[model samples]
Target: MLKFVKGHMESIEGIATYPMISLLIFFVFFALLFWWVFTASKRYVREMSELPLDENNQ
Candidate 1:
């Protein structure tokens, strides 16, 4: 089953670029996430952190 799938995948056109495109997308997503985490406000982080413990949340 695996061999059949691999053979079919290898026959597709421009298949090599698929991995590169996927990697670029993955890298961009994490890069943006890292930037967001660092740029987020300390007050906002504290508020989110305490949300689960806040009694009024229920």
Candidate 2:
């Protein structure tokens, strides 16, 4: 059973590399997406979090 599965996997070109590449790509994409989303809504995020900018925050 294991050998059957292994033989199938070995037959596929770059199947092993696909996961590593996709994982790295996903992380990179997610990181960039989060950065963009955060920067785009930074003011809103801060306001929602109630983080006062001044000492006597309004």
Error of 2 at 56 (Å): 36
Quantify all predictions' global Cα lDDT against the true fold: 0.98, 0.84
Candidate 2 structure quality by residue, lDDT tens digits, 1-58: 9999999999998788889998999999999999888687767877757765555675
lDDT of 1 by residue, 1-58 (tens): 9999999999999999989999999999999999999999999999999999999986
Q: Each model's RMSD to truth, in Å?
A: 1.3, 6.2
Lowest lDDT sum, 10 consecutive residues, model 1, at 49-58
**Highest TM-score among the candidates is held by which one?**
1
What TM-score does prediction 1 earn? 0.85
